[model samples]
Target: MREEKDARIIKREILPYLAPGIAKLLWGKDDKFFAGLEEIRLRIKSPLILKIGDRDYTINRRGEITTRLDDAYVVEGEDIYRSIASISDNSLYAFEEDIKKGFITIPGGHRVGLAGQVVYKGNNICILKNFSSICFRVAREIKGCAKGLLPYLIDKNGQIVNTLLISPPRCGKTTILRDLARMIADGIHIPFPHNVVIIDERSEIAGCYQGVPQLEVGVRTDVLDACPKALGMMMAIRSLSPEVIVTDEIGREEDIASIYECINAGVAVIATVHARNIEELERRVLFKELLKSKSFGRGVVLSRRQGPGTVEAVYRWDD
Candidate 1:
């Protein structure tokens, strides 16, 4: 009964802020609780838990869960709900699964992440049990973020320009990379002419939910999601016949070797790394290789001014 009341309260309170399609569903009963945007997302992942305190929780690809709290309220069906008073409802955030650098394996591998407070215990940071709010960044795909970055990648001599895109947090760096793959795959008429192969270690870039791209990556991009960068790169070379290899977040031994492999094969590469500037990239041993090898031809760096998801700046590594 209390849960039902909470659900009703949420519907009454939240509908005003939701988009029209979602607001309509929240108002309807049978259809409301079933197909409404909120339920639609929850139905995709059973036993969904929305944190109402301050903390983080994670469910792995193998269905193993590790959370700081011993208990969490689960939302199973219509009559279930919980309420948090005076919490900001429009804040944007990502699910907890993203921290693992992986998406959730919900029944169909649909992922969910929880975000809130970080409780630290002397070198150990854990999520708090009192979550005042949560951020749900649905892992959907927009296939054209990379379209603008491709031309710069192709050099004047009919070869793809070596490029790097760097950005802090959510500046659409990955989104751009995804589109670049599509353009390359579609036989981008850049100076460097080659089909593109995407090495997507995390499901983020391609949003590969079911061994297929959730975003439109053009007709030519071939995506290898959920594999380590190194292995994925080699796989692209040995099997995919790619002229260009792209990936997100490099600076690992395994990843460096794969970058070397791509260059050795005379393939143009585009990838992103986490750094404020060329200096931070050097802090990581993996990045030092980039400086020494001069392997990556271009670099893009991003900054988030106020918070995550806010796009701030795009820096060129090659420049």
Candidate 2:
């Protein structure tokens, strides 16, 4: 029943943005395809692609991906428009801000990546036009992924530690972050729950739809969905009195500065950054201040060597 429910959610949230023919083609596929489906890529004049697990397949017009050119389905501009209308619910103006960011979060926490011409005004992106491509990244929550890291994130007193997750893109940084947030909020591996404020800049961590989180973050977690990390961190600190502040993909100078402030305020932080390993993390000029200050007492590195969310190594500041 749970699996069926998940499938229904995906179909309802994602299929509307697809052209009728393409939608029918995808819906007609075997259940196995949807079981591990990760992303759907649509490019104008190019083949329709599906990313399932770690493999990519090009879907044909007949609802099958094959080696023969005749079997491959080519995407069209009309498909793009139909998808845009579907995603925006026919009101593109309402999502102008998200479009400028090159992505929009549909219901069920699904994210649609957009690409096309960019319109800028005074060094800021004002609009996106002439859409040519779309990538729908399906969101999944693996509840136990954070269990392995719980030992490292908690101390003897049952207090959450100041931790930072490091990984390259597609290494499941956000996935682990989401899981940890749940664990922290639920008091898993700890004596009692802590107040956790999530600065969910991309809405990926909490998957908020209409201001409500679609994913299970935990009973004690408060999410600032789609809010900038830097600003949200400050806001969480000032108002939430959080014992732990959680966020994903921290790279900006302002973000680091805010983390410093949070640490000084005695709030433990769990955050992620883009880096292959400890050495690379230390070498980055932007991260130098935080690294030198030892703001993050513990570090967890992730990779796809085994699979997404694979824990390569865990480090302590004194290590």
Candidate 3:
């Protein structure tokens, strides 16, 4: 189902950016390599590593299994150059802003993590130059992954509820957020579709390529790709008239204020934050006021105990 779509992204969207030798190695490894692949790490003169599930494996130049540091292919500077060229479509200036963000979203919603020297203009990061590494993160859309969680986010009136998804890094908060957007926007089991606006500050949620979402968010979803969450949320409320505004990883003070504004305007928000559990989330200084007010009606905590997206517990605010 949805798993098959992600596999195609790797081949059609991601493979073209890879250097010839590395791509060939990955291709020769079999479909399992692509199926299980989560990340591909390429560093200058370093081992070519692939993250599969929770484990990492080093592959040699010939795509053979290799653990020895010396046996692994030493990624060169040219490999990075070619990758940047392919990801940016030979127009690096067009993606200059994304480069400053430390990543670029290519054609298939996949993100390429950039690393190199920081060029600063005053206190702000102007750009990243002399790139030495590229980490490919595969974008996956589990169509019905959020189906089990949707019931908790709805009331008897069939209206969407304000919810927050809490999870630590690499715990699939963005993935769940993306799926939820699709369901809410397209009206999975709901009687009517809710207008969903996604504030994709990192371009990870919607994976917009050239302003068009590469991932299937939904027919009704509106995405403010690569826009700051605070500004984007305000913009969505002011213009898009969304019933549910979805965004990832909200923690900053401005983000909190924007959420309040959205709620005040009668818009439900579904956002993610970094916390192990509700207790940890409440303890944080930035989240204290928001938690105290119970602005968010429901909170879902995720953990890696049973792997990413494992819903450990659900908390409801009694208001």
TM-score of each: 0.59, 0.95, 0.95
lDDT of 2: 0.87
List runs of model 1 lying over 4 Å from the truth: 1-102, 105-110, 114-136, 188-193, 305-319
lDDT for model 1: 0.54
Stretches > 4 Å off in candidate 2: 1-6, 67-70
What tens-digit string does per-residue lDDT give for candidate 1 at 184-252? 776654543357777777666666665776666657678887788888898889998887888888767
Error of 1 at 189 (Å): 6.6
Q: How close is each model in CA RMSD to the real structure?
A: 12.3, 1.7, 1.6
Residue 18's C-alpha lDDT in candidate 3? 93
Candidate 2 vs 3: which has more lDDT: 3
Candidate 1 lDDT score at position 155 = 58
lDDT value, residue 198 of candidate 3: 96
> Which portions of model 3 show Cα errors greater than 4 Å?
1-6, 66-70
Give the Å shift of residue 33 in candidate 1.
19
Residue 255 CA error for candidate 3 (Å)? Answer: 0.3
